[model samples]
Target: MVPSDGTAGRPLRESIRDKLRERIIEGTYGPGDRIVERDVAADFGVSRLPVREALRMLDTEGFVEMLATRGVIVKKLSRRDVLELFDVREALEGLAFRRAAERLTKRDATHLGALRSKARKALEAADGPALHGFNEEFHDTVNRLARNDLLASILEPLEGRLHWIFRQNDRPDQLWREHEELLAAIVDRDGDRAADLAVAHVRVNRDRVLSHLFGDHPEGTAAAG
Candidate 1:
């Protein structure tokens, strides 16, 4: 029988890097937090070289910054950085929405509906993690249904940045409402409308993040609780 324990096969450096990357993405290490190689090596029962390899890998992925004098630190996104991330999201996702609408199939519609239902339940139950996962599924489904590999490839990285920023603020019910409306537009085969809605949806999120981070709202009442 193949050993199920992760200790037997791959090099320790790759294993450590994967584990550290997962933790960083899951918010285990918050912005500007210092990662001590010796400490992590002791905690994981590995040598410091593997831990150092993991930290360097994280730096390449934009999750950590290696300071000349301060070792490795988790990256913190500034207000401008958040906006730039959303801009990338809008461009790629807008293309996805347009193409998905242009060629949406019955199966695609069915899958989208199922995703919407799941997202609705997650929202009602106030399940933040489940809701975020569902939201990603919905968008990824649309991109796949679009039959555009290049667009999907571009979206993959931006999706991670979106989650990183969105998780910093509270989930808003309006987000689900907007998703439903966007899905409805796509289902109706209105490519132009769907494309517009897709861009607006991303813009609204960017606005929300900016508001949460910098106290700038777009002429609206306070978000309902």
Candidate 2:
């Protein structure tokens, strides 16, 4: 039970929703965990109305499900669902990499390098949350460099889902290595190579996650038992 500070400028319900979402991302409320409205409201020192509204919004975002008997439960992604999401992410991110390669300047490359450095340090420290934040910053930088708002809009939700999946992953080293390679291709201004690397990078992550979820192998292992 984490109490909200009640200091944010947003509406009460929105703030509650954001807090719950953060908890979900931080694995405080993991997949299949029950989210009781009464518990959440009591935890946040709020009424059930706001809690219900927040849960409804989270449901629409695919973060939770409201079942007849289960009430509200945290959403869990199946292997097939994860693979399909990776397919979409791979396509969009590949395109983003191609465009970013064409538009990337020395300054942009330097900025991306800084992000990669931060991510690498986070990985070295074994800080999963920090690594996730830096990873988002890196991809967000690439998306912005692509200079296509529509593409960014389309990828935003998918990126959120990917973030959720990534939090469940245990291979920060592999992920950072892929990021390093992708950044290298982008810095070299090799659009084709960057695009290909981006696709392969996502596929590798997808496979690793699937192997963990459905197979006997440990998380982050490429082999499926």
Candidate 3:
């Protein structure tokens, strides 16, 4: 939750936006679900104005679509959307992993390890939602360590979207193992290996999600099945 600074209007709108975004991410508001401004306002005990403003912000962020007939609904992901997200992420995160490896420090290592430990516990408990948040955090921490403002700026908007996609992950343990391997390479300052692992990990999750969405074959790429 975005803790309010005991203010109103803009901050309230932003807080509502964050709460709405979190709902969308955690599957409370699934894709194509119509969002009513008045309903949201009633739920939050606020006026419809802030909810309207919050929905407008989400619309610009590509999280929701405003339709004249249907009002505002969560944006549904297509096969192309999934493919494009992973493609862009692989390209950008490759750079992040390498740069983070170059700048890895003892404190960074400790923090990454701590997150991994928590994520592992989440996995053991079969907590899909908790695991999803921690997974995103691991990637975000690596990007922060990279010290690339431009890259992070480009990625910031994509963060919620990517979390939405990755929540479809079926092999959480396998993905966590890959994360651990990448973390090891970064701490060891093996930039080349770390970058390669990061790209491969993205590809692996992409395939898993697509496979789940499309059946045994992902993106219909099987030639001789």
Candidate 4:
């Protein structure tokens, strides 16, 4: 079965868009690669209209670019783009962890505990894709525990690109360890420690991504965040 995309009843356009999005995220369709509509249509066994609509959604979400002359292609992330995104994430995520630590309900903690267990099992099983999804869910669960609607709304727009970065992580064990540390702080109800750990997590991931993309460049040049 094709997995549910959480798109509220699996509208055909959303389903197609999500499949294309997953391909792009997992590097099956890479940066700057053209996604021919007819080819995607054939692959999905559908007509071109849904493919076009899905491309439009992906375009708006900053996943791919729609072009009149060249068709659709995956969007490439500039170094500056990645760095600035991490900057925003550092601020927002730090706050989310702090608030969540301070205000965690028993139910919220239970949900987080379940997610943590699942993520750890996925890590142990060497399930890369499952761990990638769990990475996003981890952050989003913390944000939800924060119980701030304004913050949730702000974080919503950046989630797709953030998920893209999470998909870029080649070191899930390290990522899992970092998340475990942060989760530990939250469970201990140490708001300040949780906030510090969150900032450190974002910074290290930022450096890792920069190093991967631009090759051992120093702090200020490529990572100007």
Best by lDDT: 4
Q: Which stretches of candidate 2 lie over 4 Å from their true place?
A: 1-9, 216-225
Q: Rank the candidates by TM-score, best first.
A: 3, 4, 2, 1
Candidate 4 vs. true structure, TM-score: 0.87
**Residue 127 in candidate 3 has what lDDT?**
80
Those runs of model 1 whose alpha carbons end farther than 4 Å from true positions after fitting are: 1-19, 41-50, 217-225
Give the range of the ten consecutive residues with the poorest summed lDDT in model 4. 1-10
Candidate 1, residues 60-148, lDDT tens digits: the string is 76778999999889898776677677778787778888888889888888888888888888888988777766666677678887898
TM-score, per-candidate, Cα-based? 0.80, 0.85, 0.90, 0.87
Arrange candidates by lDDT, highest first: which order?
4, 3, 2, 1
RMSD of each: 5.1, 3.9, 3.2, 2.9
lDDT tens string, model 4, 1-225? 233332567777888888898888889999999999899888887777878988999999889987778878999988778888888998899899999999987888788899899998998899877888888888888888888999999998788788898877688778888999998888888999999999989988887877777664546545353
Worst 10 residues of 3 by lDDT: 1-10
Over 56-130, each residue of candidate 2 has an lDDT whose tens digit, in order, gives: 989988889999999999998766667677778887999999999989988898888778778878887888768
Please give the distance, in angstroms, between residue 5's alpha carbon in candidate 2 and its true position after superposition: 11
Clashes of 2: 0
- Using TM-score as the measure, the top candidate is 3
lDDT of 2: 0.80
Q: Candidate 3, 95: how far from true, in Å?
A: 0.4
The CA lDDT at 80 in model 1 is 66
Error of 2 at 212 (Å): 0.9
Candidate 2, which ten residues in sequence have the lowest lDDT sum? 216-225
